[model samples]
Target: MEYQEAKDKFISTWGSLGTLWGINKAMAQIQALLFISTKPLSMEDIMEDLKISRGNTSMNLRQLMDWGIVTKVLVSGERKEFFTTEKDVQELARVIAKERSRREIKPVIKVLDEVSSIKDDGTEKTKELIKQTKALHNLTQDADAMINKLMDQKQNWLTKSVFKLIK
Candidate 1:
């Protein structure tokens, strides 16, 4: 396939994947462009390439920066900023996992804890509620522990090797 067509395909795929992960399509598309480009691109270049307005480009760029996926680069002898993507897939996964844990898992854990703490009455319904809440709390807590362990072991070669062997 032609270079531009291949690039377009990559951008589309990335954008769709981003939507599944709760990120904006434009931001992911921009990041995908930066990831494949040999050199950093200016905001104007991104806007032109993506066919988006300046405001839209700027907003998505800022969001990507906030997510730690993109970084700014100043061109030599030019005031305009360029951008690049974090090419390390492992780091990307680690950041995404950490963010999801904070955003989704932690809040769910709080709710589970609250519900599980409700006074238990003798009614079958109340008993069922207590049972379900307790089970949810245990499952969430286990997941939290697993995430923490994975995050801690992410940089350790032996830990990764062990996991691969077990799997």
Candidate 2:
């Protein structure tokens, strides 16, 4: 298809995928747009391109910046801010994995730790809660370890080989 059509499809798909991952659709759309753009875009440009309001664009851009997926670009001689997306897929995945681990997995692990450490009351409900929390803690800890390993592997050839083999 044509370039614009392809971009539209990409934005739509990315937006939907973002929703599935608990990210706002508009933020993902803005990310997709920046990812495909040849140069940095201002907030106004993003608003116009996405047909979203200033507040919507501003809020989403802030969120994306906080997540490390987007960065602000200060064009020389220009006062308004510009934005760009991280284009490297591996880096993008690393950022997203780290962010999710911090936001979701870490808190769950904390709760699991607290609940599992409680002194046993011998009640069935307490036993069940402890058992479930322990299991969740183990699972989340494993996931965290795996993510850490992957992130640490960065440019290691052995790590790349292992990842390929696993895949």
Candidate 3:
């Protein structure tokens, strides 16, 4: 396929996969565009290329920045603010994993801990609730801990091995 067709397919596929990462289609599309661009793109450039509204492009860019995946870039001799994303795929994955842990898993873990720590009133239902929640809390905590450990090791041997094994 031609460059245009290949790029379009990649952006579309990435946008569809964005929902799995808890981002909207436009946001993913914007990231995909930025990810493949040879240089930083202006907001207008992104909007035009994606055929999205100005507001949509702006909002999604802000969200992507919040997620630590995208950043505002300064263009020499250009007034328009430009944007770029993490170019290294491994680094990008690490950032997204860390952010997701903080934003999503951490909150759920907190709630689970709170629910599981409630006083045991000797009632069967209360005991069952505590038991179940504690189990879930422990499991979630372990998973999160593992994820954090993996993310902390930047391009470590183990991480590289794991990725290789997965592939």
Candidate 4:
């Protein structure tokens, strides 16, 4: 495949993958663009190249910055801000996992705690509710443990975990 075509395909594929991770299409597309760019990209450059609207580019860039994956840079004497992403794939994945654990998993764990705390009224339905919520709570706890391990380790978390398990 040709250069531009390959770039387009990569951006599309990455953007589609982002949707599966609960982010919007434009956000993922912008991430993919920043990932492959050698230099920082301005909002105008991003909109023009991605064929996205100015507002969309602005909003998604802000969101990316909030996620700590993308960051803004100043161009010497230029007013417009240029953006770049965390280039290391492992570091990027770790950051995303930490953020998702904070924003999404924590809340689910809270809800599971509340639901699992319901008093036993001696009904089959109540028993079932408690049982199911307990199961969900267990799963969330495991997820939380994994996220914590990922965030705390500097390198080879999986390898360390495997060794720990065997020992």
Backbone clash pairs for candidate 3 read none
10-125: candidate 1 lDDT, tens digit per residue: 99999989867678899889988998989999999999999999999999999888888899988899899999888877777777777778888899999999998899888999
* Per-residue lDDT value at 35 in model 1: 87
The per-prediction CA RMSD against the true structure, in angstroms, equals 2.2, 2.0, 2.2, 2.0
Q: lDDT-based ranking, best first? A: 3, 4, 2, 1
Candidate 2 off by > 4 Å: 156-159, 164-167
- Cα-lDDT of candidate 4: 0.90
Can you give the TM-score per candidate against the true fold?
Answer: 0.88, 0.90, 0.92, 0.92
| Higher-TM-score candidate of 2 and 3 | 3
CA displacement after TM-score superposition, residue 136 of candidate 3 (Å): 0.6
Of the pair 1 and 4, which is ahead by TM-score? 4
Q: What is the lDDT of residue 56 in candidate 2?
A: 96
lDDT of 3 by residue, 1-167 (tens): 99999999999999999978888999999999999999999999998999999999989999999998999989999999999999988788888888889899999999999999999999999999999999999999999999888877776646578788978
Q: Please report the TM-score between candidate 3 and the true structure.
A: 0.92
Candidate 1: 10-residue stretch with minimal lDDT: 151-160
Misplaced by over 4 Å in model 3 are 156-167
lDDT of 2 at 167: 82
